[model samples]
Target: MDMLPVDRTNAECWQLGTDQITVLTTCAQTSGQIFAVEIRMPPGGGPPVLHRHDPSEVYYVLEGEFTFYVGGEGGVTRHRAGVGDVVPLDGGTPHTVRNESDADAVAFAVHTPGAVMEGFTRAAAVLGAPGARPTMEEVLALADAHGIEMLGPVPAQL
Candidate 1:
């Protein structure tokens, strides 16, 4: 299959929850090899729940700082990552990330063998619109459809 070059400058950005998500490379674009997205999160913003999915995710911090929570048999581990840091989340590992700094955060997230994340992100962008708070049930249903399992709420402290 021929893979065309992607110019993100023309990519559309969608508000997925509190973050701006720009799908840089979609599954269709890469023939299911990868899915890449750029996310811009406001201070104190992040995903609402810790979740696990089929695709391994790698995050490269571009600006500001973020706190990541990874769950394991020993419980959850918290770590701080700043610009230029690379954080990898293995497939089936439950984890979440947040921007706890005073400034906004920018990061690039890449999923290997790109599952349905691009579609999931697009759906989330619409369901989580301003003044439209999606219920936990709604969120879980969406996640389930994308082969993701919602674990629990994000950690209280960064």
Candidate 2:
């Protein structure tokens, strides 16, 4: 049996947002269904530009409240999640989540088919500086850079 933990710092961790990221699993060694931990907007942290993945995802809230933007949604929805809240996601639709509270918003995400996180980081770097907010154009560029073809223009900002 595999008797070792994957070191997160050694994994391909990257900042997809000014305060968000794709942290590789430190204990799972990419085992099971859990692949990474996505922490978005620390206490008082800002939200990331809207985006989505080609694979399915799950956002299990670990603390604080946040706003969720699911694809085709009429308006933003506010969900106060604590240690036990889970938000499931399918790859078909686009979505973005933001911390609307004064505390950190932690979530664990499982991605089927490992290495997509690495692709996100590489794409982010090519399209925009890591740890920085990306513009709509930049996001489109990043998507293209990562081999994810753009289907339509970015939604108009509210």
Summing lDDT over every window of 10 consecutive residues in candidate 2, give the lowest-scoring window. 26-35
Residues 1-158, candidate 2, lDDT per residue (tens digit)? 44246455555555555566656553245544445666766764543445666667777776676566666556433445677788877775566666767777777766654455456655675555645666888777657665454444335564
Candidate 1 lDDT score relative to the true structure = 0.86
Backbone clash count for every predicted candidate, in the order shown: 0, 1
Candidate 1 per-residue lDDT, tens place, 1-158, comes to: 43357676788788877788888888877788888998899998998678888889999999999889999997888899999999999899999999989999999999987857776887888888888988978988988988988888865654
Give candidate 2's root-mean-square deviation (CA, Å).
4.7
Return the top candidate by TM-score: 1
Best candidate, lDDT: 1
lDDT of each: 0.86, 0.59
Off by over 4 Å in 2: 1-3, 9-12, 20-22, 26-34, 43-49, 72-78, 125-136, 147-158
List TM-scores for all candidates, in order: 0.90, 0.65
